[model samples]
Target: MATIKDVAQRAQVSTASVSRVLSGDARTSAEMRERVLTAARELRFRPNAVARSLRSTGTRTIGLVVSDLLNPFFTELTRAVEDAARAAGYAVIVGNADESPEQQDHYVRILLGRQVDGLIVVPTVETSPLLHEAAASDHNIVLVDRRAVGVDAPIALADGATAIDELVDHLVATGRRRPAILAGPDLAGSSRERLAAFRAAVARCGLDLPESRVIHGDFRAGSGHDALAALLTGDDAPDAVFVANGPMALGALQHLAEAGGRAPRVPEDLALAVFDDMPWFSLLRPTLTAIQQPTAALGERALSMLLARIRGEDVPDERLECRLVLRESTEPRSAR
Candidate 1:
């Protein structure tokens, strides 16, 4: 197998020079670094990341554990993180937790075992203690999108407070009296944050949001379908409803279209709004109103913080702001 020695010989340099170049030592001249890298690439000489990490030189990689791959927000987060990580001259190892606490813990353990330099995780609801223990042990952990229940790690998130207020005020001005919410899972911290923001906005706008109007879903399309169906069948159905995510919003639209006699047309029978803005949302018969979070910025900031933490730097939490985009579904465009 090709080794550092082979690369060193190919580059006409000593093994120590090759090591310095491969370890990202800034002292190495750019010409020497290029020569070493070209030789390593030509020889297909791969470094033993574990061995390098044992010597405290790092694997030159970071691990990212996503909350759920199905969520478009997370998909964008992954892309943004990859772009930032690559630009920083590092590799990324990604793990999909599927929004399960057990799966999240398992992936975290695997990533730690792989000896990645640091971790960027989106904590699941009721996450296990291993994560907290790792953070306490100084494993260079950083939370993305939401804070864990007990982990005291640095966090990066997107705040939707102003957008929620704008949505509520817009609804009130448009003559909508009753508004409801199709919320995410009750146990998730992020879900609670969103619910709290919506509730506060409703109260501030002088709108009534009864406990019965809050329907919890599992942040999936199917659960959104069922939740919307329940709300629509209730004795006092809402005149307007807010969906917490893109997939759920699409699912609720499906239920609305197929409810036969109970079906409510967008902005006419029932106005609809959502927290996440997707490209396809604009192409729907009635474009959806949505709040667009700075997902790319959130992901980039999380990685930047994680990298700093890996370098033994203390970092503060970050909260990016979101913007509300009103469209036909909210009667802003007056499509009907």
Candidate 2:
């Protein structure tokens, strides 16, 4: 119920001064800002965001529509974005798309409807019409961790080439001759990049990556489970596998833990590694060998790009490097 005028009176400052201080205007003196803030806090004064946004174009808030929150990669990325945005005096509204194009489009509509100053989208695929429309309309957007085809926006993503190559080298040196990959949906940008890097890595080590070894998953546990089940058969079954993401790695491990069925003991019968390192990975009996994406960098970089675009600055896509972390899961076949 407290008004700006009430706080202004308490601080003995004009309403205009209070407005400037509350809006984070740099022109406000430190002493005046402190006085106004103290009075406002004492009075429990809350700014009318709707009225303020009506007067100014920027809401001082942006939206982040991510591919899926179930994946810890996105969860960590979200926290990073929140931290950077908060430090820059902005707030974030996060939308979880759950890897559904329709859901992503719906969230886009809702986020734009809220008049968000800008948006950072982890696109579901390259064919999202709304993404194109938003770019064409000049709505501020920055793609993170993935790209939407033909969306003329700056992007911040990961380049897993070097890490994948390193992973392959490690596997080969450890005697994992026959290695395979459990990839995500083929159309997804990250999936395509990772698959390419993985194949190129295999080839570099004089190994063959048959199309049959490239099993596709939906970046979820169930799909990962099914993909592993499909690959674990016949004389040609792979001796090693690299799961593309954390959830899929979990599912693949689950398949190996089936209660009554014969399961291949890891590093004994099979070797395992994964992309997208998670905190809990180390807790597993045999810690997982995983690739760690520059998750925090991705969030901070994407948000900075989005903020720059909002400020009428031109930005370009940049890719961060990934790291291969060694753990017990991919130990040498001889040691096992």
Candidate 3:
């Protein structure tokens, strides 16, 4: 309930002087500003955000829209974005689309309605129209993780093709001829790119990947487990599997443990490689081999791009590289 007037009275200064001090007006005397700040802190005074936003035309808030909150990839990205935004003196509002176009559009409207200073989105393919509308409206919008088809917005993305190529090359070099892939939903922008790269790599290696060896699943642990079960139970089980994300990799591992089936034992029966370098991956039973995306850097760079756009600066689409991390799960065939 403490107000600016209370702080001004406690500091023995006028309300105008307190306002100047709080706003960081350079014209205010340093000694007076310190006194007002000390009084405000002692009184537990909080500024009226609504009034301040109305006056300054800035809410100091950035909206972040992600496809899935449960995925560790997005969770880590969110943490990084929140931390970077806080350091830059902005608050973040996160919205999960659940990979649904309707939900994505709903959150977009809500964020705009709330008058957030800017938006960063991992867009669904169906929401491209909505994104285009927002972009045409002159709203500050930046794409993160996924780029839209027809919309031209500042973007931050991983090099999906190169990452997948590296994984394939490693598998081939390790003496794994029959390789399977568990890919995320093809509608997702990043997923589609990964699938394309995977196919191209297989072709270049003079390997033919039949439709039976590829399974499509949502980027969830359960989906991964189910996909692996389906593949292993079928007639043609692969000598190696490349899972696109961390959760899927874990799920596949879980299924392998429970099935008690023979062949493709860790590094011997079947080698495993996946995307995303999760914190605990290195400590797992076989210590997973992974293609590590710079997730923290991706989140930080997305925030920086958004902030720059909010400041009226022009930014272009960007792609960050992925590093391959070798571990016991993908030991050379001879060593196994």
Candidate 4:
């Protein structure tokens, strides 16, 4: 393998000079630096990142922990984060927690063991203590999507309340009085915020959201399908259903298709609205109406925030607004 000594000998410079040039230490003359770099490149030399990290005390690696990789929303978000991290000359290590607190804790320990320079996490409920401990130990940790209970790290989240309010308002304007909700697990911070906003919107519109109308599901397509099926088959089926995220919305659509005679027609027998718009949604039958959170932008921002924190900069928590996109599935009742 090509080593610094080989490159230095080839470039007629000392090993120390070659090291300075490779590290970009700014002490080597420009002409000598160029010659060393050319010699290294010609020899196909690669720096040992592990050795360099040991010397600099920085791995230039960021660890990302997500609740579920199966969800399309999270998949896209991860892509954005990885792309941005790579562009910034950092490596990313990803872990999926499957929405389990124990799994999340396990991943945290593993990442710390790897000596990752920083962390970005989509926290599960009851994981605050672990996060707190990391923070206390001076680890650079940033919360993404959900904030843990006791940790004060910078957070990047969607404006859940505003998104819910907009969805409810759209449903009301389109003549959906009895709107049901498929909420995510109550322990999740995003789910709680969305549900709270939904309830407040229902009350503000003078509509009684009965306990029977609210169904809880994990933020997955299957859970969404099952929850909507339960709600639709119940004694009082909703005139409209608002799903909290894209996968759930897709699941609800799938269930609607499989229910046969009981299937509620979009914008006719029933209206549908969802949070978190995806690329394929607009092309679906009866096109999905949704509140579009900036998924890629959210991921990019979270990574940027974490990087800033890793660099010892103070970054405040941030929330991005979601835009309501009206589509065929939620046409005005009068138009139908």
Candidate 5:
């Protein structure tokens, strides 16, 4: 309940002097600044963020929206983003889109209404009129993970090309001719990019991937489960499957379990690999091969790029690389 007046009295200075000190005004004397800060610390005083934002150039806060909070990849990205934002003297507010465009739009409005200095989003849809308006109005927006089709903003995303190459090479080398893919929403930039890379890599290895084997999901476990189930029950069952993200991978694993009990023994019956890596992946029954994305780097870079945009700096789109991590799930055919 301590106020600016209380701090001013405790510091033996006028309210104006206290305000100047708290605002980081260069005109304040060192002795006066010290006294004001000391008084604030002693009183446990917290500034009114709204009032401070009104008086300053920024709110010192940023808003981040992720497609799905259930995904460990996004959770780690959120943690890294918060860490980087805090290090840069900013606070972060997060919103989970849950792969719904309407939900994403709602959170975008809420964040904008809260007067966040900037926004970073993993857009759920291909295009959004609201996002375009915000960007056009100089709202300091940055796209992370996936780029909205019509939103003209700087973006930070993963480059899955090399990882896909490595995955295809491994599968082909292991004598797996028929490979399947569980892709996320086809409209999402990240999903599209990953699918494209997968196709290209398969072609590079001179492997054929039928259209029926390319399944799309909503980046959720249930969708993954359904997609994998369809593939498993099909007449032309694939020898290997690559899931797009972690939650979906978990779903695929679950489907594998429920579909035929212990019939599928990973590399023996159906090899599996996923796009995103997690600590627990190594502990799974057969262990999982995955593409390790630089999640921390992606978060840090997104914040940095957002900050730059907020400061009126031109920032180009950034794409970080992902590396393939081989594991028990992708054992060679001979070993299987």
Candidate 6:
């Protein structure tokens, strides 16, 4: 087992210098930091993070709870958070809540019990008393990708309103008068925000979005398929559909393909757009249009904000915007 003493000896520096370098103290000279880091790397010296955390009252670890691990958006965000944490000399523990409030709360308690230095959560619901209590008790916490009310923590949100506006405009320009939504569960902040935004945008465009046009799902592929099926079987089916999140969008696409002659063919019979762009979207048969949120940036900024809070710094909530990515699935019927 390599130790700090071995690293200090190899670097020809004092143990204090090595400690300062490892702690990211800006006072350490660049040359000394380089020497210490090189020696540590060469010796494969792993710091006793747990012991240092016990003494300093910090775990040097972050806990992240996301709504759905299977979702590509959340998956990418998780990777980004890990990358950012690693760069800052910290480790991240992830919990997938599977869109269950109970599961999310369980992870929250577990992470808190583990004494993580900070927490970043993509909240499964707007009401989590445990999270609120943790915040009130001065836990270092931040909400990412979703917002939870009554939690005294900074939040990092994406511009859902703008994305919905773009989606509506595209649908209307593509000559789709009737539009529907395959929305996520109502308890989730992201779902509620997107739903409200869609309603407002459609109304602003002088389109009547009846209650029947909106269908709720569990943010899963199966739920998405079911929602799409309901829409297709309806007497007055929509000419365009907006799916919230990527996994659901994929499900809706699959449903459309499998329906054969029973359902409308995309573009020619129906148009579709989705939130959360994926790498494979372009490669799909008809290619899909989507709103692309800065997933990686969201994760990085959320971690940075949580770290700042853990360091006793005050920071404001952050809001990032999504971009509209046009593709064949949303092209005008005439153009396709």
RMSD of 5: 10.6
What tens digits encode model 4's per-residue C-alpha lDDT throughout 1-336? 998668867986555456556777554567877898999999999988777657356778999999999888789889999999999999999999998998998898778766687889999773467677666545688888887887868899988677677778878888888989999888898888888889998888888899999999988889999999899889988998889888888889899888867798888879898888888989998898888888898999999999898778999999998888889888986776
Instruction: Give per-residue lDDT, candidate 4, residue 115.
Output: 63
* Reference-based TM-score of each model: 0.83, 0.83, 0.81, 0.82, 0.82, 0.83
Ten residues in sequence with the least summed lDDT for candidate 1: 12-21
Stretches of candidate 6 off by over 4 Å are: 1-55
Winner by lDDT between candidate 6 and candidate 5: 5
Candidate 3 residues lying further than 4 Å off, grouped into runs, are 1-56, 261-263
Compare the candidates by lDDT and give the number of the best one: 2
After superposing candidate 4, which stretches have Cα over 4 Å from the reference? 1-56
Residue by residue across 227-256, what tens digits does model 5's lDDT show? 998998788889999999988998888887
Which stretches of model 5 miss by more than 4 angstroms?
A: 1-56, 260-262
- Report every candidate's CA lDDT: 0.85, 0.88, 0.83, 0.84, 0.87, 0.86
Kindly give the stretch of ten consecutive residues in candidate 3 with the minimal lDDT sum: 12-21
Sort by lDDT, top down from the best: 2, 5, 6, 1, 4, 3
RMSD of each: 10.3, 11.0, 11.5, 11.3, 10.6, 11.3
Residue 65, model 2: Cα distance from true site in angstroms: 0.2
* lDDT string, candidate 3, 265-324, tens digits: 888878888878888999898899998998889999999999898787989887999888
Q: What is the model-wide C-alpha lDDT for candidate 5?
A: 0.87
Q: Model 6 Cα displacement at 117 (Å)? A: 0.7
Model 3 clash pairs?
264-269, 264-270, 265-269
After TM-score superposition, the amount by which residue 203's alpha carbon in candidate 4 deviates from its true location, in angstroms, is: 1.5
Q: Model 3 Cα displacement at 34 (Å)?
A: 50
